[model samples]
Target: MAFHKNLTRVERARLAVTKLICPITRDALRVIPLTDFIFGIYISSRYRYVYIDNPKTGCTSLKSAMAELELRGRKSDLDPLNLEVIHYDSSPLKSFVPIFPKPTLSNLIKNNYRFVTFVRNPYQRLLSCYLNKFDNSTAKDNPQARRMPRGAAPGSFSEFIDAIIGQTDHDMDPHWRSQSINIHYSRVPYAYIGRFENYATDYVTTFHKLGIPADEIPTLRHLNKTGAGRASLHEFYDKKSQDAVYARYQDDFVNFGYPYELPD
Candidate 1:
């Protein structure tokens, strides 16, 4: 790509890995046993669209809309907002069996289906995860999560970021995991990856890519609110914490077009 000519070596390398790495063979696709742990992947053999849901990036709403799309078809008589998620949940470890036959799962991956997902600014996503999962004084989480100091969120954020930057992708939760790591660029061929920065506008374009008309798409709904009781990303990130986010999730920033520098 001509764009690659202008990118720095590191940026170009991330691009190369994201684009060049994932090339799953038909035989491999055929043998991947469907299970509950395949968290956010939605395969619609009916519409031939495969959606990989990135948690905390409007996944619940997207999955619900997708569930209705699968159940009601492209021209849904049902409302997307009223629809429920039958196949997917945010729990990274839980999985759902494919509605399609075992053999058909292979064809869906190998055939005409468009594979799509949305990504967010990694720093913002990290903040959202902390607020939703750790900042809460009431909710139960991983025993490790309980240890992140509250109130002094920037320090906690910095501490948490440091831990995961050194850890493997699977070792961290999806909310804190690197987007590039989640997608496993080398093995999965995703047809479209949109950014949540331009969510409403980009979503219309994404819906079209999924073979759904813009009119057919519902008014985008907000299902989850990690922001309600907490401060936004801006309030929690100091210069040190900001730099940590940049260093830790730079692949996401470079690949997804987020600014490298944090806002003042």
Candidate 2:
């Protein structure tokens, strides 16, 4: 579909080969996950901006806002709240690998593109992931949840932490994956790394970095909020769960500068 169109020629060719060999390999040689990782990286040549999406870290709002800028005040078919539309090929912001050849992308990365991403506190991010993806209301419909091993109780936050402790970032869903891994911090030279904790102000800085005029910067909207009421981290986290999450995403805390202890 349009989503698959985001695959570069090389990626498409790789996928084709993987498809043929996957059956023989009992689907052990899957490339779809890697392709999905690439899909999280959106680029706009017109704006000279590259946004690496960190799921559950204000990505929907950021992408939607950027799409608005890319569309140049025109109405967009992509909705911030609609995951399918915002992420698909029809969106104004294009995936980097698919839109530019490797050499061109390398040049742009080295000399032009302003790469930016937002990261949330690991504790909050994991809680949000569970509330959105593993809750009884959502888990049955979520593909990632289905693929996950059945151990965590439908809405048990601590169990959810237990369920994914050993999984590598490559195999884990981006929503709960380490923020540093999601953004490939070691590999990508980020021009700005905003914190989800300071979303309102940080996004304005991001829009300015993208060269969006102050008057033209779209109002940031909160999209894909999980559950109703204020779900505090303390309610779901205890010494064990907090320590487990810290161990799992310690790199995120270190790389993103979030404190190890939960904030009051």
Best by lDDT: 2
Tell me model 2's lDDT, rounded to 2 decimals: 0.70
* Per-model TM-score versus the true fold: 0.69, 0.81
lDDT of each: 0.59, 0.70
Of the candidates shown, which would achieve the greatest TM-score relative to the real structure? 2
Tens-place lDDT per residue, model 2, 1-264, is 222536677766655654453341113223226555557768787888778888888788888877767776566566544566577666677644532223233455766788899988888888877777767353345666753567334447776787888776656777776777677677677788888888899999988887778998988888877742267678888999888888888898888788889876
lDDT of 1 at 18: 34
lDDT of 1 by residue, 1-264 (tens): 112225677644543443333234222223231121145456666667777657678776666666655656344354445433333342211233232223233355666677888888877788777666666535444543633333223236656666666654544556676777665444566777877767778777778888887777756776777772345666677777788778878788887778977533
Candidate 1 ranges beyond 4 A from true positions: 1-37, 73-107, 141-155, 228-232
lDDT score for residue 125 of model 2: 83
RMSD to the true structure for each prediction, in A, is 11.1, 5.7
> Candidate 1 has which clashing residue pairs, if any?
21-186, 22-185, 22-186, 22-187, 36-94, 36-95, 36-96, 37-95
